[model samples]
Target: MRNLHKIKLLYEKYLNRTATHEEVEELFMLLRDRNQFQHIHNIMEDEWERNDIDFSVENLSWEKVRSEWPTEQKISDVREMPIEKHAIWSLKIRKIVAVAAGVLIAGMMLWWWTKTNTKEYRTGFGETMEIVLSDGSRVLLNANSKMTWNTNWQNIQERTVQLEGEAFFEVSHQRMPVNNSSPDQKDSISLMPFQVITSDLSVNVLGTSFNVASRRQKTDVFLKSGEVLLVAKPPLPRSKNDEKKTAGPSLAKHMDSIYLTPGDHITYSGITRALERHEEKLPDEPTSWVDGFLVYENEKLETVLQELKDIYGKSFIMEDSTMLSRQVDLGLPYEDWYTVSELMSLSLEIEMEENNSEITVKKLEK
Candidate 1:
């Protein structure tokens, strides 16, 4: 029998948000153990009764919770557990999930933990890095970006990675024999889909190059060389009222999945709850930053300024507001802020006054 005291402490740590990664994994594993389910269930119930919060699962449907756990063992656990016990389990789930945003979902944590071979890469502001996966795929991670994937893919069916911020992917095509196939069928190979998942959408491709950016509640995908399948959903409602309104309806007729060809660009805005697809004549502009430069083709001066602000934390004020609306085509290196400012001034015929925190732009003196 597992130690009840240790389990309780781990659960308490999880609720307190003080659990280490291994502790969190251990707690979830303990909860999934069929042999200790009764003991753990009783402990949770006792703990809930002791707490004074008005935590309720009365409005939550059991089917919804069951659907979250796809594995047969978890499903069996849900089926056999008494209805009242599900309430406690759901409450625990809600508390665990409420701990943070951008963290892995609790339902999938067990699977992630079991694999225990996941790897993550990250880059800081004004910095870029290159990553090579085990499958010979290459990724150029942009500044302020993060990507994670399971390192051990020998047994996994789909090759998947979770990404935040922006990155350019050069995914290598890989194939495996179909599961449950006979010896004669070993010659048949099927392409394993490579998926890049973000907060707003997922891109599925095989042997393709693409760029993905997810930031500030918006996701953008640009297909460079091959096709990609984009799957998107509306942002999860934050408040109870939002849940009531957005819970029952699908947002768009074409929102579920979209197939993108080369040069196809897609944007999904969480704030507006909309997905838009457009064609870009110059696909290289979207990924020029991968080469340590920002390339803009007929982009607004204001948009260019915002990119500067986002990348270098340098704010800009345009005294000639009309310049903000004027579209400009330009390319600037990422590392040199002074050169960027000079180029912007020369290109727009404006003078930039720079301070520690902000830059003011004015019409050039004759």
Candidate 2:
């Protein structure tokens, strides 16, 4: 049997977050000990169900037991009789079991507390949000997106966040530790490294502004200013049956990293794991949908319609590819749904009708 008083004090320290590093290490070691693990687990399970603890607070006391005694030994001394007494020995065992259970319960509660309190932010459909990070960097989250970081974000060893969907980042300039030399070069002062992970690629930046667009199966990254390193990771491996029957080209294992300068864009084609770089002058319109409209430059009607469908969630079915092909130039205004539809109709000489909330484009057929 273990000492109930000592276990209780150690658990108190853990709840307070005042336990020394050594003390935490010892407590976890005790938890894994086969002889004590089960008893500690039971005690903790019972206490959590009986009393709710406010996890956010820095300090907590077991409300039921707090005022009764200062130390577990004091309580035990009062409740226990001489060890020679049969009843006393039995009582001591019971108390030990109860304390063990408490320890187990507290450990589990602490795990849940840490997970639940972590900072998480998400955007819904047709919605977008902008955030100013602790370091004065900025992030603009697109619709149906999520971003998360630790609560102690400013103090963490590394500044990091998990991004899903799409976002644009403007990182703050801060000196970060760097290696003395690259394997291929001599030592020099290198800037702090920042990273953006997507389904298709991982972007490493040293204080720069960029946009990341990652869908479930595709990813696109565009660098607006500063330099970035783009690395493409291989897709997850498939099972034997899946591998044997696969139809397309074999996935590449080595990642291809390309140094991107301003005005460069890299797109990953999901099927091939091949990266295509566009060096042409980027469009003058705002790449970010939140700030301004996207104007197509002499784009085909079909292409313009496809772009609108992506942003506005409205689909257009062209009856005559010939009419769409004949109209070589078209423009679709964003921010106003009706105006975009009207413009499409006037420019293409076609009528648009909404059926079951979906737009269908049809030519006069004359």
Candidate 3:
């Protein structure tokens, strides 16, 4: 019974967002211990079903509890329970059950609160979304992207998020007011960097706008405005047994980062461990898709064809590899497939024909 009271206190602390990290971790560990919490969870579920409480809003936060308590009191006023003297034989059993029920209710409240309060946003294929955060920072999520953060953003020491796929952020410059408990008295707003972590690299910035492409196979970063730092993962250490078998002298240290100025793009290839940077020239067109345009300049014919297939669902076949290698410098508007094909043909001096909806390009023999 004493242990049950301690658990209830910890749960209340968690709901109030006042629990330490260690305490939160301990609470989750206890919840996941099926042998300990399974019976409690089942009992709580039944109790919740019988009560006419609105579980959806109640599960999201403790703020609703204060608002709903008054209404619940009004409802309870109409019901009356008969008082009975406790029988000696069943008194101990009743006390034990009451304590167990209290513990169970607290556990269920904590579980539901955690599950519903966490903020998560995701975009599906060919879908884009814009998010305005509580801090006034704006995020533009590209196709097939996901972003998530904790709900206790106002109380947390730092604002952070986990992101996948691609996004462009315009972060607000206003610094959040720090609590008195914070150890650092000096304002470290610049030092507190925002991070976009991919599978192989992490991009850190204080306040900047940049594009991040972090698909499984390819990871890329393009800095449009302000400064950003890139950190690549260190190579894994070889095992003792395999060290002798592999006879490649000592491995050279890989270049983890190459800082980018505005209009600079860096691509990190995991298979090659090579970090390549290309200067952004005229027709800066990589992120044009966000603006509803496909602008390609001096792009290879094959590369442009692949882009067309991805966006317009149009496949192509090149009879001659040499012809396909011809680089074309053109900007095809992203309105329709026919317009794009006409623009490409006009720029490249080629004949484009659609046979069963598959585009075929042929160089004019002249």
Candidate 4:
């Protein structure tokens, strides 16, 4: 019975996206245990019956499921339909049916102790949002960005977040304010460090505010207060059998790291292993997008388009072969898609066609 406590804690960590790599694998193993599977199955079955839901296929064979699923009624019923690309009719139907069946199987296998302790923050294209974390830290997410972390951050070892796209963070400072801990604790553990991680770069801090932009194999971090350490992703260790197939020698000797203080900016290139910095007396330029206006300083045409994507949560395509190195300096409001497209069309002297959320830019005929 004592081992059950460990299982529950590990399962909680897995749900919060805080579990280590090995812990994730172990959690999967635990979920697949026959007794645990039966428990979840029973719980789900009871709920389905209570709701008068049609779950008659719970005992169907895989072959039968493949042949019978994707009924016309089922296809139209799913709320957020998966994007279907052009493919062979047979393959398309099979994929659609598989997606529907997979949802049912996934629902039966799920387990969670508390939904409130884990939260996900996302912004659709053309939308920006702000939310306060469990530790009183505030995060302002730009358009098309996402941030996910456990709400029980204070009880965990460190405050960490998985990040994508761009966001500005304001971290609250406190010393070892452990959530739900006993008042009569004997040993005093120091406050755990905070980390914001992307695929190419990891920013570690104890307490600080910063803005991060991550895209196109590059990560740009602008520190407004406190300090941060940027570490490059290291190569995964090769397996023993693969090493025997034999390469001559190692290519790089050491990893790269950079330290930043207030009013500093660092951009880590994912392609060339180059760490570039701009030491200017920083303006609010890096984060002014929060105020509904975008500021650029001789940025490339492609980079400006990327910034637009961050705000509108949509994509732009170039119809003609234009110089990507074309630079521009402009400040435009990020209110709506059509307005932003009009500003781009006027500033770049191009014709923009907007259909749905996609914008296509074409060169004007003389």
In the range 173-224, model 1's lDDT, one tens digit per residue, is 8988776568887678888889999988788899999999988788989888
CA lDDT, every prediction? 0.73, 0.61, 0.62, 0.68
Give me the displacement of residue 272 in model 4, in angstroms: 4.8
Off by over 4 Å in 2: 1-118, 149-151, 176-192, 235-254, 279-282, 285-290, 300-303, 321-333, 364-366
lDDT tens readout by residue for model 3, 129-224? 889877667888776678875454454445566677777777655455433556675554433446677776767677777888776555777887
Model 4, position 327, has a per-residue lDDT of 82
Q: Name model 1 segments beyond 4 Å from true.
A: 1-116, 180-187, 235-255
lDDT of 4 by residue, 1-366 (tens): 434445556644543457899986665555543345445444445444554444543664666556655557655554345444323444545443533443344444444422445677888888889888878788899888888776556555568787888899988775774454676764555556888988786788888899998877788899988988776675323345434322335334544455677888877766666666665432778887877788787778887887776667566788864745788887889677778778877887888887887878788776
Candidate 4 residue pairs that clash: 125-312, 125-313, 126-312, 126-313
Compute each candidate's TM-score over C-alphas.
Answer: 0.63, 0.57, 0.55, 0.58
Q: For residues 1-366, could you state the per-residue lDDT of candidate 2 as single tens digits?
A: 565445645665765457898987677655543345456545454444444432221233456334433367755765565656746544444444445445455566556545753567787645678888776678988766788754444333345666777788898875644455576544444555567777676777878888887764667788889888766676523445433323244235555455677777767755577655555433433363646555655556775665565555676776666655553454444355677778767866778998754887887455
The segments of candidate 4 whose C-alpha lies over 4 angstroms from its true place after superposition are: 1-117, 177-191, 235-256, 269-272, 279-282, 363-366
Question: Residue 173 deviation, candidate 2, in Å?
Answer: 1.7
